[model samples]
Target: MAAAAADEADDSWMIAQEWMVWWDRPSWYVTIVNTRIDSIHRRKREENEENERVEGERREKKRAGTRGEQGEGESRRTTGDRATWRRQVKRRR
Candidate 1:
């Protein structure tokens, strides 16, 4: 049991030394910082894309509202007034 305990302790010490050597490397710190920066940039890009998608949907709804509920090639102003329709078209322009 004593010999087994000694072997375990030796193995742990070797692992600790290897960890210390890795931690002392400059590339380890640079890699950590670069990873964090990349994560931040990716998150911001996703947020911007989601915002743009929502804005596009809002604009489409606004256009549809202005056009009324009429189908394609159908006039929304069904009052048969030609002068009124012309005035409406001019206002839109």
Candidate 2:
């Protein structure tokens, strides 16, 4: 029965009755405080998730931007190498 009740209380890590008995507080106080703490944890989790998602998107955009810049550099390097090779061929001829 305890295990079954525990499973049903999955929404909170803290138990209201446990808090009431442990704190020697009133039932209403235990219920309100436990519910408040659970809500705070939930809000924090949501904020962290949102922050991570935004940071991931920012990093992805930065990486894509760098890839475009590097592509231009690679093409310029190739052109420079080809130009140098052409000059050498002309001199030989």
Candidate 3:
């Protein structure tokens, strides 16, 4: 008979009774606080992702810009070398 009574009062019932005793505040207040905390965490994660994307774009642009400058310099130097060689050949003839 005692075992049967104990079985009737299950763990879920005990937990609910304990929770009710501790959280005497309104349910809406708890919900609002939890929602605000979740929102803050979500916003922070989004901002961090955006910052990372922006940083990646900036680095890519810098690398491409330097490569373009080097290519232009090399092309100009090659053209100048060719012109100087042609002039030397004409003078030798």
Cα lDDT, all candidates: 0.79, 0.72, 0.75
Which 10 consecutive residues of model 3 have the lowest summed lDDT? 69-78
Candidate 3, position 47, lDDT = 100
TM-score for each model: 0.47, 0.50, 0.45
lDDT of 1: 0.79
lDDT per residue (tens digit) for residues 17-62 in model 3: 9789659978898889799999999999999999999989776655
- In terms of lDDT, which candidate is stronger, 2 or 3? 3
Clash count list over all predictions: 0, 0, 0
The TM-score of predicted model 3 comes to 0.45
Candidate 2, lDDT over the whole model = 0.72
Best by lDDT: 1
Winner on TM-score (1 vs 2) = 2
For model 1, how does the per-residue alpha-carbon lDDT over 27-92 read when each residue is reduced to its tens digit?
978699789999999999999999999989776665554466445544444444556778889999
TM-score attained by model 2:
0.50
Best by TM-score: 2
Name the regions of candidate 2 deviating beyond 4 angstroms: 1-22, 69-93
